[model samples]
Target chain A: MLKKLLEFLILWIIWTLLTWSLALPDILAGVVVSAIAVLLFSDLFPAEIGRLLHPRRLFWGLVYLPVFFWQVVKSNFDVAYRVFHPTMPIRPGIVKVRTSLRSEIARTFLANSITLTPGTLTVDCVDDHLYIHWINIISEDPEEETRLIVEKFEKYLRKIFD
Target chain B: MSNLVIIFLSIGLFFNFAGCLGLIRFPDIYNRLQASTKCVTLGTIFILLAVVIHFGWNSISLKAILCVVFILLTSPTAAHAIARGSHRAGFPLWEGSIMDRYREDQEGETESAN
Candidate 1:
């Protein structure tokens, strides 16, 4: 099946990257390992592989990297400033925010992204609601918080995963 | 190229130092975890990125990129697990804290149960 081949290709690419050699023995070993992995994990891949392979989705995924990187840098500076400030200003709290992302992968990705970026850490996700611990609780409204925390990442992630 | 690598290294070091400072100064375990997780993740990724930039496109660079990817995926998950564990263990927040939605949610559930 197509999913099996996709899995095999992904695994083989990782193996090649790990070994970093194209010699005959290495290639043969990689092929064998990748094929076995595909067989073992065939059920894990989503039934609809077409979405994953879509050109627009792939492009948006690539676009997301730099945006994420920039946010990381900005957040590093923000945390650094807060740490050094004499007042040690922070309004830490857990706020409930709802996410529209339906897929588990997308929700997980959003949570991870929130944790990695400025002033927010995902405490839990129950149903569609995410309890996020905010170092600086700017807005109490869940809708506003969702906009501040999840919207930026969700647009691209929805394309990639949903 | 070397200058860029030095810049990256310096930025990484600064972030790492900030993370340590945060760990010492933050009021509670959860806040400390937040500071340490984000700073360390960004710091480590920048350091690995510097390695890639310095080495160019080769085996070592590829491996460095792989490490970056793995760290990106694992660090936040680890932080989330620690935060959740400590919260479940009833870790106290700082005195100046603004909200406790998790506790409220639990209370709500119990009230409904009754």
Candidate 2:
């Protein structure tokens, strides 16, 4: 409990710094208010007692981030080409794909990862299957398209978080 | 200006650029969201640290505190809503995925329904 409270203070202070404000006494008061809010949130939301911490897999996780970065750089042009071309060669549709990451956090991350980019969006995730909408799926094969996105993310997430 | 703070700020700016780059580069909505959220969250935290140092009072300090507070509160919520919204639209997970627990549960429920 004490540790959680300390985290609350640390979190509040971080918030105070973010805005670059100068109000002293008020900010202090705000911290208490925010702390209370966090406390209430904890009370309201019962956390599942599970092995929340994943075992150390630091090397792959760290390596994976750069891999993700490269994909982001490469994909930007692919998307831009489709969007800006005088005669847009676009093949947009919804496709279903599967993933290896079963943990909710990894799955959620994978889902969010897809949505963050330009042309494709994760339409639905029921269990392990993810439905994605591509503004331009380059190949006609849904399997290939889903493989491209999932393999990149899941491989890293499995290493990083699970 | 503190050298440490300057370093953090420079790194934060780099993250900001990276996040925007992800927004531009990724092939779909979900991937872009991942890059922006992770990068911006990290960048904003660093930027906030610089601000906290620049201001030492209570009230403004409080607002800075509030900024972080609100960010923590909203970021995941916003992301969750977007993901669920997309999922309902019928997007699929990638291939080589080994599980579909949700499908099993849903199927179980529907079978029981019958």
Candidate 3:
């Protein structure tokens, strides 16, 4: 299947990058390893390879990295400020927020993004609601919290996964 | 190039130090985990990025990128697991905490079922 080949190609690229060698044996080994990995883990991949291969989805995925990295930097600075402050202003609490993303991949991606960004950690997800431990409980309203926490990432993620 | 590397290195160190400060100063395990997870991850990634910049496109840089990828994937998951585990274990939140919607939701579900 094209999906399997795509998986193999991705794995092979990573393999080559890691090895960084053009020797015949290295290339042959990468091919073998990548093939085996694809065979074993194909089912773990997103079911709709067609959707994944869509140019729009690929473009959004590429765009997501810089946006995510920028947020990470911002969050680090925010947390650093909180950590170094004399009073250590924090109002931590668990707030539940709803997510519109239907796919498992999208939901997981959102959760990971929330956790990676400073000031929030996803405690749990049940049904469409995610329980997040926020460093500063800005608002208890689920809709408001969702807007504050999930909106920025979800737009790009929806494009990529949903 | 050397100056760029020093800048990255210092920024990384600063963030790492902030994370350590957070661990000490934050009230509870959950908050501490948040600090450790986010700050340390960014710090490590920056340090790795610095390595990549210094090494150009060789195997070392590639390995650094791989490490960044692995950290990005694993650290948050690990933090989530720990936070969830601690919550389930009834690790108390800070005294200044305001809400616990998770417990309220669970209680509501049980009440409706009963």
Candidate 4:
């Protein structure tokens, strides 16, 4: 109950901040509403609430942003090149590759990372394997491509949210 | 000079630009997401930090702090949701990944149930 109250207070504080409105009455009302919300919803998903407040996981994310930023820039230019090439030297195919990670959290992070990049879309992931749709085929070397994708993103996710 | 603010903004801009570049160059979905999530988060925080400083130790600063907290809260969850949804819809991982313990467990359960 104490933890729930703390969480509620934090969230209300956050809500008040995001609104950029610091009026005392609003803050009070916000706290009240959030408290009610917690009361009504606590039994529905207690585990998720616990996970949401996981500090260790969030701390790692603080370390992750810089690395991820660098990768984004490099891919943008490459994606642009593929799109602009008039002859359309793009190869469209879905390739499947396995993952070493076990948890749904890790695997899901991997999938979203792939899709967030420009030229590739995460078409699927079954049994720890990813099905990716690629617009530009830099090479037909499936092993090399698979290695590059997961090596590029999954490694960092392990650090950030593991 | 308020150099801290300037420096922070510069770093923030650099990260945001880097994220955009990664989105362009990466070979597939996984890599691009990494770039965006990392760069944007970092860039956005720095920007928010700047806002806080600019606004001074006032209500705006308080709000800025809140923004950071909320962002710290939701961004990963959003990314996770998207990734899981994609995977469930049928995306594949790379070949070198030797073990998929999650899949193994799922299969194991189904097999035993049957």
Per-residue accuracy of model 3 over B1-114 as CA lDDT, tens digit each: 788988998888999999999999999998999899999999998899899989888889889989899899899989988988888878888889989886777723543455
lDDT agreement of model 4 with the native: 0.61
Q: How high is the lDDT of residue A93 in model 2?
A: 52
Comparing 3 and 4 on DockQ, the stronger one: 3
Q: Give DockQ per model, in order.
A: 0.60, 0.11, 0.61, 0.12
Give the Cα-based TM-score of candidate 1 against the true structure.
0.86
Clashing pairs in 3: none
Provide i-RMS per model in Å. Answer: 2.3, 8.8, 2.5, 8.8
What is the C-alpha lDDT profile of model 3 across A1-162, one tens digit per residue? Answer: 888988899889889888888899999999999999888989998776567778889999999999999889888998899999999989998888889999988898899999988689998877788889999987878889999999999999999999
Off by over 4 Å in 3: A1-16, A19-43, B107-114
Cα deviation at A150, candidate 1, in Å, is 1.9
lDDT (Cα atoms) of all candidates against the true structure: 0.87, 0.60, 0.89, 0.61
Candidate 2, residue A138: the lDDT equals 62
Tell me the tens digit of each residue's lDDT in model 4 across A1-162.
Answer: 776876687668667766666788887888888888878876643333346346776776666666655554454554445444555345544455667776666676677556545455554566666656554545556578778777777666665544
Sort by lDDT, top down from the best: 3, 1, 4, 2
- Give DockQ: model 4: 0.12
> Tens-digit lDDT track for model 1 on B1-114?
799999999888889999999999999988898899889888888899899999998899999999898999999999888888788878878889999887888723543455
Candidate that beats the other on lDDT, 1 or 3, i.e. the better one? 3
lDDT of 2 by residue, B1-114 (tens): 888778868866776676677577655555555555655655676677667766766656566667765664466447656755654465553342333333444423443456
